[model samples]
Target: MNIVDLLPAILAVIVGLVVLVWSADKFVDGAVGVAKFCGMSTLLIGMVIVGFGTSAPEMVVSALSAVQGNPQLALGNAYGSNIANIALILGVTALISPILVQRSVLKKDLPLLIGVTVLSILLLLDGDVSRLDGVVFLAVFFGVMGFNIWKEKKSANKATEPAEAGELAEVSESAEKPMSLGKSIFWLVLGMGLLVASSRALVWGAVDIAHSLGVSDLLIGLTIVAIGTSLPELASSIAAARKGEDDLAVGNIIGSNLFNTLMVVGIAASISPMNQIDGEVLYRDMPLMGILTLSLLVLGFRRKGDGRINRVAGIVLLLVYVAYLTILGLKTTGVL
Candidate 1:
């Protein structure tokens, strides 16, 4: 492709990623600020509110794509985001700081994540996610949400004084800044607007680049669009990690994956059945997703390592992701 045609797409991706990251930070801050003002528990805010915010892009995009009859794009976006959440997002976050898994996350969240991944694969094995399948997914998603609420309550009751004090300290810190309700709400709206805008720009640029390179839309959705949409998770996770909020960093990834698997796909399929999904989804992408989930399960439960993903592990994850992308590129270019 000529430089004149290629340059704008490249610039769009760069600018989109930058803006997405900034907007996510603002979004999280405003959310946290408002939640604290309302006297919500830190655990609840982190677990439920922020988690949903980060996955909003995938949900919206998938829903619209499904309605537009581009089921592959919808399906690819969800599955591809899950893959990106684990391999690309977590890998990069761990590289920035070794992620220490919370005991609660290891015990409950990790296992649920694996189970959900397997469930998603089973649904897709028949080569379509029908409305019935979507109903099942939504059932599981709501079940998981209820379980999370129960877990949070139990944790709250059992929380030690030190942990409670730490949470309060965080709340107090936010209180010190004292964001006015109007400003907090303003940031929330503005951040969401910018998020959608940036996501569109990123997707448009990625699609343009893919078309110019003769890459199929499915592959484009899986690679460029997937990564573009996942920028929010990557940014939020890395920001949390740098601040030593280890649990939040890891939790964000887990929550986003669950949302992608259950909510995004479920809503999309229920709106308009996704039929005749590419065979690669079954034989290739689904297996890769399952394997990555299994790998995370094993890596996250290391008795010797205290559930830590070190830089070495990070590099390994990144390499696996790179290899997966390379294979996709080869296949898209008819080299495979």
Candidate 2:
């Protein structure tokens, strides 16, 4: 109940995050290396491999939270990560370098994100994320994944066409040269081991902190846990932006959000259905996520050749995120 009691839990979170980010990078590197060997498209590698790899934290954390009988933390971690992906991750990345992208590439993803955001809200309205609801999400997740694979294959085929042959550069152009498959699998196993261990430490500490602070697990998840798990996406996105791989940077955000919304929540809820819905999730969190998603959608719809989210927009997004955090702080301190 005191600061002294919170120390170990705090330390767990700190150490857990440090290891979590490091391991996720290793995981993605290994995964991407293998994908490159299979000759996957550059954009596909960014969206699926890096996006899903970085999102493994949320999946692991949420699944553990649910299995350990903390479904609120699981649900909060999923939705909260979505909020952070847009307002926090994208906002910070844009500040480092304004996001520039071809709207054609974004055509399928942004709209699909909006659709799923709305669908998630509708599912929440019944006051619970039921097992059946989780099934629906999982089915949709697999469907999206199937589409991504097909789309990637289609892109490869289209790129071979004489008219589009200009885009037929190397598949690994966005990333460094590929490593050997044996080495890739070695790091994959190592990273996955560390990733699960770190996730368990994080979940345990976060739940303990919530109990000690007399706050809901949902609150802890939405704030500390959400931000911590999202760190990999932030790091990768910034690195991609600085490297001028704008599509890769943007795809990582968009894809990560999709993974958080569907895979993270679906796995958790399927493991243990969230029959008790938190009010803040529907009233406060989902609405904020919806708004941020819509704003990002609007920012991408420029008729100009390349839609650019410039510095000013980045500042505004950051301000909105800060305002949301301020509200959480006031609520925690009983001042709201």
Candidate 3:
């Protein structure tokens, strides 16, 4: 592609990434503010609203790509975002400060994330994601979410322990106070609108860049688009870590990865079935995703020192991410 042809796509990517991050922040802020105003418990707001809001970019981009007849882009975006969320975002967050794992996360969220990751990989093992498979994934997604909400409700009722109270205090202390109802609603709507627009621009740029360079859309989605869409998580996690909200930072990654692996992919496949899954996706990307998820689960189990991910572990995860990117780069350069 000539410079004239390349410039627009590159510009779209740059602009889209910026807007997507901005909109995601706005969406989370508005949703959190409104949820708190509505008298929702801090646990529920943290568990449900923030989780879904962070994954919004992946959902929108994948849906748009699937509708536009680019299932590769859709699938890649979901799975790639999953990979990046854990490997890249968590790695960076841990490097900033060792992330302390909550017992709830280790026992509940991490296991569910692993199960979902494995389930997604198994579905793609056959080289296609049929509508039936999509339905199955969606069924599991909703079932898991329903059970989680129930469990959280139970915990909310039964828990008034000192540690629990302390955690709740931290959450409440960090949460912003309510604004006028009208302003909250406005930000919610505007954020959703901007998210959709930015996702469209991102997918278009990624697909165009893929085509122009004779690279697979899957690769483009896996690398550029995935990282772009995940910027919000990276930003949020780092900020949370800096504030010493280690549980919040780690929980954000777990929740976002779960949503990406299940809900985002399920919605995309149900919208437009991916009839031909890429071989590399099964052999390459999915394995890496599984490895990262498993690594997090193992590291999170508190054998010593409050089950935290230290700087050494952070560096290791970062190196793994860099190695994955290097492999993709080589593939693009005809060296792999």
Candidate 4:
């Protein structure tokens, strides 16, 4: 790769990442505002609104990759972003502040996430995610969404307090006025528009970089593309953790991972037959991702009280993520 070729791709990546972060911030705010305005519960806001908002980049990027005849890139981005969400994003969030798991989250969300992870692995074991598989994924995802909505509505009168949820719920019930419906919708539309555009730019740059480096699209997606698309989750989760909205912070990670696991992969496989998914997805990425998903249950397990992921645990998660990237780099470059 000449300097000329490298420079533009690098520039595109940097600029694309910057815009993605900013737009994602606006998107989350707008989504939260809209959810509150519509009377959604805080957990629902964290999972549905914030989760969908942050996971938008992964969804768009994967869909575009599939449409462009890059199924490997699509799978890599979807599953890679899943690994990043749990290991990188959550690791950093917990490093900044210990994350507390709510009873509702442990009982409802965590087990579901584990089940989803297992399902993903089983689908990939067939060496491809078929159209039927895609349909199944979307069905399960939507069903889970419906169930969460029903549960939240059923417990509307006994909603979680702000102390457990942190600034997320507090802000909704705060004396400070919230954004108007029109304004929130405007930001939501604007953010979604920008996300689509920036994701295209990012995909272009990623393809170029992959070609230049003489690596597969999967490699690029698993690293640069994955991390870039995941910046939103990292940003939002950290902000939530700092404010002591432990459930919101943790919920964001869980929600984003779930979306990537189901919606992103499902959309990609549905649009483009992923019959030749790389072996690495099944043997390497998916296994590690499943283990990490299970680790959440172990880390959040409580003997007598609420579960907490502390700084020591945070350091361990961070180290695991760092090692993961290192191994990916080594393998991509034929060093492993």
lDDT of candidate 3 at residue 237, scale 0 to 100: 67
Candidate 4 lDDT tens digits, 65-131: 9899886777877777888888888888888889988766777789999999999888888798898
Which lDDT tens digits does candidate 3 get at residues 53-129? 66887788778888998867767777777788888988988888888887667776788888888888888888999
Model 4 is weakest, by summed lDDT over 10 consecutive residues, at: 156-165
Ranking by lDDT, best first?
Answer: 4, 1, 2, 3
Q: Rate the local accuracy (lDDT) of all candidates.
A: 0.78, 0.78, 0.75, 0.79
Clashing pairs in 1: none
Clashes of 2: 0
lDDT of 3: 0.75
Candidate 4: which pairs clash? none
TM-score of 4: 0.78
What lDDT is reached at residue 124 by model 1? 86
Off by over 4 Å in 2: 1-39, 161-225
Judge candidate 2 against the unseen true structure and give its global Cα lDDT, from 0 to 1. Answer: 0.78
The TM-score measured for candidate 1 stands at 0.81
Clashing pairs in 3: none
Top model number, TM-score: 1
